[model samples]
Target: MAALAATDSADLEKLLLEVCSSPSWAADVAASRPWSDRGALLAANAAAMARLTTADLADAMAGHARIGSPKAGDATSEREQAGIQGVDRALLDELHGANAAYEAKFGHVFLICATGRTAATMLAALRERFPNDPATEAEIVRGELRKINDIRLGRLLDEPS
Candidate 1:
């Protein structure tokens, strides 16, 4: 909250986009600057995301890194998927295969919060979700994107000086 309040508008927009790569969401939040606190910021984010068009959601989803593939995304994503780091080669292979299967079915990267989940857990979830139809999967994707945005937003404010 303090950090956002102190940041310039352009930088805030960039930061918001980094958290959730939806231009509409980032612009709306940037326009509502000087948030009273983190709660208000979060509420704004949730509302903006709720109102997101399919394109916006797709834009946000496109920003995510695949689970167990840290090299595929930014520093934030690398950190977010830290739990998958240092896992055994077999688990990494499984996660890669699962990611490929998920992408084949969904036509996009499998995105989750991945803040504190292991490769095995993520793989299990990916497999568990394979049977879901597109509509169901989209809803799940929306929920996961929201979680990822929330975690990223918290981290933006939590960064050390």
Candidate 2:
């Protein structure tokens, strides 16, 4: 927290963007800096996230890789989607099909905080959310994004020893 609170504006913005792809969100969070603890930083994150417009949320969601197809070299995505790493090929194909259906329905990748969740669990969520109307799904996406952002922020402030 102290390190981030003391980082320069540009550096801070860059770091926050890694946590959330939305420029407005990063700026909003960076502006509320000098946080004294994790709770304060997360509160700031939640507030900024709540203020995001539809377009802003879209921009934020753009940062995440689709669940089954983690980007080749993105450590963040790889780590967060670790549950799918060594799963069977049949399950992977099923995940791919489910991802396509979800995307077609929502017009965006299914977003979930996959850090500690299994691939099967994520697949089930995609199926569950597939039936939701766009507005409700958008809110759910926002909530998932909020969880992801909170985890990323904690990672940013609390480096491993």
Candidate 3:
């Protein structure tokens, strides 16, 4: 969307603010050099996410819940639909339980690369990763966030309307 590139800095700022609630992070993303491709744009966004402190990461997580496969009627919900797929109801229930337990243990939401993964697979991953120490989990969470950004940037850079 080169037209988006042509947008003024203030408009760009507003757009990013809509995408991410963190003011400092949004400002940094808006001030970044114009990207020629989706990959570059996503890389920059991921780098910014990686730089956030643990508390900041928690705030970002609060902005996003699990990517729901069948999106509800809301912007943020639709955004989450990108990474969701239908799965067995039982598996979904188990995943929800696991997610709650994981959050209680880690003091942060469970994060995973959800693109193309089924609920069962994601649940298995969550269970497997539950044993990692906080430092290790933080790195994993950053990687998952980068993957999500990559998906979002691809959508953003699609051919203009």
Which candidate number has the best TM-score?
A: 2
- Regions of model 1 farther than 4 Å from truth: none
- Global Cα lDDT for candidate 1: 0.83
If the candidates were sorted by their TM-score against the true structure, best first, what order would they fall in? 2, 1, 3
Query: What TM-score would candidate 3 get against the native?
Result: 0.82
**What is candidate 3's lDDT per residue for 40-143, written digit by digit as tens?**
67767877887788776776666566533333665544545443455567767787788888888888778776666666677888899999999999988877
lDDT of 1 by residue, 1-161 (tens): 67678888888888888888889889987877678988888887787878888888889887777788776547877888998978999989989998898899988888877888888888889899989998898888888888888787888888884
- For every model shown, the clashing-pair count is 0, 0, 0
Best by lDDT: 2
Estimate TM-scores for all models. Answer: 0.91, 0.97, 0.82
Off by over 4 Å in 3: 67-71, 75-86, 159-161
- Residue 40, candidate 3: Cα error in Å is 2.7
Which residue pairs in model 1 clash with each other? none
For each candidate in the order shown, give its overall lDDT on alpha carbons. Answer: 0.83, 0.91, 0.69
